[model samples]
Target: MTDRRGVVAKRAEDLMPGVPYVRGWNRARQSASALADQLVLLGLDSDFPGLVADVNVVGDGLVQLGTVRPEAAELLATLIAAGLRAELHGTTAETPATARREAPAA
Candidate 1:
């Protein structure tokens, strides 16, 4: 479908997050909102729902993840593979949000 700008638009789900994965990401990068949706696909939702509560799209290739457990850090490699970079914020006993070391993705 073409937008008002006359640019052919692709479905959000059809766009992959990583560059090497598909050409969809290229078109996705042109729109901030669309790219953000693509990034969500790379999130640790299935196996680690509690691990991440929220995903905030910061930019074309950046996202801030709200994590409940330290294990959420294990997603770094997957995130990288998805052509995205992430910052993890975990809830701590001392505070609601704190930076913790990332653990390996098991």
Candidate 2:
């Protein structure tokens, strides 16, 4: 929750083919990959799985998480994994265990 500057600036008018999204870089939590394993969180075979909306590395140790659309708990998890941490912000928490039961991995 360092700063949502990126998230706040997102426009619903610029969504991708599959879902709307936002992108921003984190200065505090630098991801070896993307913020919050968003890719993995998105589940495999998803269109635009790891689409980052806005990204910026600033001077202060702060990672700005951008906006996300079709904002689902699953998608949020992925964003958080990239580097942005959200506390008490979970509403759609779905794990692989339940996923297997629902769609069973191929």
Candidate 3:
């Protein structure tokens, strides 16, 4: 499992190579919302209700799936079958410290 911090840090570094942070973040969030809607339309909400509740965007190109349930694999497989690139990042027990850490200033 890859460290969540490292994954977050890498994403932070690579965020919007030439774009403004706010603009980039807003774009990503919008895209994530659209993707989430698409997933719902694809019946993921019905197929894996619990897992679907945990899908969220933490950064550009970074959709975080916050679950350790076995169904997560099935959800990922479904996403991949739909031609979406989905992969497991490391899992960690979420805590206040981790949750409160802000992304590095751009």
Candidate 4:
């Protein structure tokens, strides 16, 4: 028998089956706060949050998006290809924040 706790840690993608992946970041030397501000300025804040349900600032440069609709997911992909530096996972089973918080402490 194997100790469940001893199992290898799963990447976010592994744990979130069917969950969409989304990532975005500021290209310039700007903080995540600034990036969020830019999203607001671009009029994306209003819909993006509701669409994704969770938007997390990773470190000082990157932002992660939680679950989102197909159209929103497509938009995120298009943004990435268009130089927004975004990443998409697939879809989300739960809020990414909840997943992170539920992770065992290292």
Q: After superposing candidate 2 on the true structure, give the runs of residues whose Cα lies further than 4 Å from its correct spot.
A: 1-29, 32-38, 41-58, 73-94, 97-106
TM-score result, candidate 2:
0.27
| True lDDT of residue 50, candidate 3 | 34
Give every collision pair in model 3.
none
State the TM-score for model 4.
0.32
> What lDDT is obtained when candidate 4 is compared to the true structure?
0.40
For candidate 2, lDDT tens digit of each residue in 51-80?
443332222232334434443445444544
Q: Which stretches of candidate 3 lie over 4 Å from their true place?
A: 1-19, 46-61, 82-106
Ranking by TM-score: 3, 4, 2, 1
RMSD, candidate 4, Å = 17.2
lDDT of 1 by residue, 1-106 (tens): 2349954433233434543322333333344344344435544344343322121122122222334355554444444433332323332222112212233544
lDDT of 1 at 90: 37
State in Å the error of residue 79, model 1: 2.8
Residue range with the least summed lDDT across 10 consecutive positions in model 2: 55-64
Q: List the residue pairs that clash in candidate 1.
A: none
